[model samples]
Target chain A: MTEGSSVPQRCWQIDSSRKGAEIIRITDADGKSLIRVKPGVSAVIISSASFLEVILEEGARLELLRPFLLDQTLEREVSLSVHQAKDSSLTAFMVTKGSISFKDNVSVVLAGEGAEVSLNGLHDLSNACEAHSLTLIDHVAPSTKSDQLYKSVVRDRGHSFFHGKIMVRREAQLTNAYQLNKNLILSPEGRVDTKPQLEIFADDVKCSHGAAIGQLDDDQLFYFQTRGIGREEAARMLVKGFVKDVLLKINDPLLRAEAGGML
Target chain B: MLNIKDLYASVEGNQILKGLNLSVKAGQVHAIMGPNGSGKSTLSKVITGHPQYVADSGLVDFEINGQMVNILGMEPDQRAREGIFLAFQYPVELPGVPTSEFLRASYNSVCRHHGLEQMDPIDFDGFIREKMKVLEMDDKYIDRAVNVDFSGGEKKRNEILQMAVLNPRLAVLDETDSGLDVDSMKIVAHGVNLLRSKRNAMIVITHYQRLLNYIKPDIVHVLYQGRIIKTGGPELALKVEDQGYDWLIKS
Candidate 1:
């Protein structure tokens, strides 16, 4: 059995601590890979049950499968700032389905000529649970870009917010960026707010943003019903389709299947 | 076989179909002709289970496979599964859902209700290709969104294409030829004529006799004041075209 297939348990747990915690660097030395989340590294963090600061160098990749659950009072911080030298790529997936408090944040800074980064995450809040995720991507070089697509489904007074800012410096010309945030209010009183900002000081760039909030399609419901799909099954299919679009993009098939089972 | 008895329906608190009655049998075509505000379109809507129209009191029964079935209590989707298809006057433009996907979903839905295995993509492609060839429609319309960005003639042809694909037991077309040119009108009628069979019935609703000139309905009913005021054979449509509804209104 692999680490992903170990448990179906739930609890409130914390990560371990680190020594000399000023700025720790995990590098993919000559022909090696960066962005390490192996058992050795994660065990150190999970065992410590505390906060730490980490920095990532160029050509590094990481995969976050389980929740980075931090206790509510600790207010832990994890910052990842990457610089792609030339023709490098970075991808990450954050999957959280439970109530996790403690002010978790991800601060990303990109600096390279032809670097691309895709940050995608999905949080499912149901049965009076609360989860918050804050993501920031900064562009510090020209001809570099980033894309963000995030979705949330909240039920029974659950809350979700995604505030993303794409900062194109005055000298960062010929940059391309896009951000999309969509939410489905499963209950009448549940709420969600999405804000996408483009602060550009350069004129030779293309940027776009959008936000949509609505209920399910009534005609689609009737269409399914006429075909003998029960109301609850139809609703489940729509909701699952909405989230599967993001989770299934992960390159690791094991992680993708795990997410599928969760749904 | 289908029957409508003393149907009354309204929309937004205004009555549209008042005490309408009609009956259609297998291996037959009935053409419904009327001027504007004569409740011709409303009759079709109420029969097809459109939610906008509220049925005050009416009964629509269909004898499917020699069994009488009441469709008044069924939803539109249920009505569709039970083999009642409405070729809309205005086909909806579904933006993201591809035509092939929509067709397969609709086809499989009805198939599943009848206890049949769903057709895979490979089989469906061949099936739709043959049907499209019969209609002389471009192959591109098969993969594109349903009626999205289609020309007026193209939309009407698409309605006929769906009729051929679903092959419903009964088809009711509402003003399908209002916007077509002469060539498109012929193509539309040809497509409909090809699909007419003894096991399936049809009701062609239009204001002019031009479409009837192509498909040739077996009977024509003149609708005025939300009711069928007159019924005649195929010659009646030609008479209405020669002497418009103005004379019929006076009589």
Candidate 2:
């Protein structure tokens, strides 16, 4: 279904009931989208797909919260793109969990001067699942800023890949961009491949990226155990703390609580 | 009360505690002094059930609620919940878990083991604040990550603070004064002294006699080659401090 060109004041939610291959275009200058995937729907047979596009005109503001619950084996894909105009701002929070094979592609372009973008994502994978998330952020105009943080927890034989690319064009001077990807592997068989790429053609721009993948620290675990916390409880505490900073990026209290419960 | 007889322990195929024996009674502080590689640290680990250590033979017994409990087969956490606390020589740093949350969880876990009610967050904060005051610690430490980016002295003080919070029946401090400065050492000693009571016991393991000056021990034992070679009063630590362990090892 297509949302008209008028600005939207109310939140919009898209679910599996919409069926295969849906596109949502947000052309309004100050429109917002709160897209949440409904729970307990099996995506294996549905093969659902969604595409989201947001365009922010001059001096416009937009916020998006997309939390997906993938409790069963499912194959699904989501594509998101955003274009910001001069003095425009966009903030987005996305969380995905429990997909057998899932793919997400997100692209944001700061095409106008004084534009800003902040994107944060959290993915929780378990039980031989394969998930991939790719994000591309482009700073095309001067005085544009963008920040991205993505964290994932992999358990059992699950595998996850995060590829983030931030490009600062030659004309995008005074551009401030930052990107980080951190993963926690809970089991020996779990695997995570994270690549944080930065392409900066402007000499005066500030850009940085970091990626890390590791298991729980033995010493830290022992510290908790020594405090009379059971092994299971200590592991749970560590995992919760590992993803807490990223999860707090979600401003909605209900959504934050839901995401925390999933972890 | 704690008792160990002919304790033989090893780690990674290396026997660290060979035929070691010791006993500690409630309301008493026992100081174990020895040279490096003399199983001083290993004895503490064996008592606390460190995962890396393997107990080949012998038994570790603790009197809990007037009953002798064999702690040899217990898990590390089980041993802890049974009122056994080990203040590590180097406390591990947890970068994201706040100190207050960790301490409260630990306290509540032990409380739950004894069929007691858990303290609410507000009450726990107050309890921890009072405990920190005993160590002369700042209130800022409660909000920071557990031992993360802490100075050497602060880490030692934090260990004492944890011991105070847990209030274990048997506390084994492993070289707690190793990295502490003079002022920090006194604060730590003061905290330990305040925790002393007739219902609890402490085993202070150290390499020097300097720490003995502050927290005076009732008995001092010289550990050598995985065994206690000499047992004496507080004067034994001073003897080791004056002449070092060379003469003891040669004997």
Candidate 3:
């Protein structure tokens, strides 16, 4: 159960020595959650909410899996903020499916030295739904690192948006950050919009960002046809292939299987 | 096993093949030599029923079940199931789809078309490995993405590998020699030569007579301005190699 004012709030304090995953459901009209991973501890959090605050103390590690597969029509805006201290690491995975109109905005701050963060996300949208995912990562300390990859498969009239910005401060020398967004539009009616921005004030940093969006390659399809695979089956294999690499990043075998089964 | 008559085809508003005609019986090897933009590749695409290459007025009849049936209306995959293949000049690179998986699916599709049970993975792996050994391709290629990051010669060899795996009856090798080195070309030619038999026909499209030296076509045809200008024995290829296509195109 969550403590609430007008909007329900679910709060959890993952104290030191915590070593397990916790699944929390945000079922209210609009919900917020506060997750704090104490120093030197590791934990996994799976949750759904409109507003989420995640804090990782020194030497803490966190893995977050966010699954949004609700069939209900969700026309809502969600925002997530994450703060990491020295020697902390955060790896987050998100899977969004359904004909729900939802917008997600996430910002991460590597506030202390030697922090690292990685985000892998995918959105499989159908119908006339509209989805948006915006990520802003800031490396504020020296020797910090960040990586982000987001992909989308939009079918029918669904439209997907992915906007990511990576900012490395002047003091964040020796930083390494990269971002890539790939999109697959299945039908002529489907659409994808991507914007990747990198602002670096540090000279001794490795940073790169890219975005690519398109339908399946016609020549690739024809190549399959030349080998006796019909157009429909060829398209299926390619679409399946498009989303597989993201799923492969999952280290937990059971979670990987479950995510694959979702597909 | 394949017949083309009065074929007029175009792609992207350009009429590339105009009134082209050819005929090949089973066990025959036909070498098509032409310069760039002469529609040698267009003919292969037309035979394979490429969607973009429209047949304005022509007939591409393919032998299936001992009958010559018009295949222009059939889809490319249908034409393939009935035994037509094109070894593209530039093979398409498919990322994320491993070579083994794609080949297995392709092989199984052909099997299903002919009413056969699916080949088990173990058997299929062994079968394809044997073919790979002949092409001199490494074991690492199968587990990687098809044609992705492969060297130019390696990509051409991959095409031949597929040809060996699918075993198409009428294979159009479209400049299969362009990217291959001499030694690699010999290996590919050897692999291709082994696949030639009475049950299959081949159309080798090339710009150089060097490839024809190994594949050894029975007939050599000069394709200029979309149509076959001259058809001769294998000696014609040597003559064309000695003298450029200018004399033939002028005649």
Q: Using lDDT, give the best candidate's number.
A: 3
- Clash pairs, model 3 backbone: none
By summed lDDT, the worst window of 10 consecutive residues in model 3 chain A runs over A1-10
Q: Give the TM-score of candidate 1.
A: 0.74
Model 3's CAPRI class?
A: medium
Question: Candidate 2's residue-wise lDDT over A129-169, tens digit each?
Answer: 88889999999999999989888889999898999999999
Top DockQ hit: 3
Residue-wise C-alpha lDDT for candidate 1, range A69-180, written one tens digit per residue: 3224433333333334434455555555644432335555666666567777676766545555666667767887777777787777777777778888877788788778
**Tens digit per residue, CA lDDT, model 3, B139-248:** 99999999999999999999999999889899999999997889999999999999999999999999999999899999999999999999999999999999989999
lDDT of 2 by residue, B1-251 (tens): 79898999998999988888899999999999998999998898889888888899988889877898878999889989999999999999886788999999999999999999999999999999999888989999998888988998899999999999999989999999999888889999999999999989999999889999999999999998888989999998998999998887787
- Candidate 1 CAPRI-style tier: incorrect
Residue A157's lDDT in candidate 3: 97
Candidate 1 chain A has its poorest 10 consecutive residues by lDDT at A43-52
Q: In order, what fnat does every candidate score? A: 0.22, 0.61, 0.75
Which runs of model 1 end up more than 4 angstroms from their true locations? A1-87, A91-106, A120-133, A152-159, A184-190, A220-263, B64-67, B138-155, B178-181
Better of 1 and 3 by lDDT: 3
DockQ, per model, reads: 0.22, 0.68, 0.71
**Chain A TM-score by candidate, in order:** 0.72, 0.79, 0.89
Clashes of 1: 9
lDDT of 3 by residue, A195-255 (tens): 8888999899999888889898888899999999999999888988898899887766656
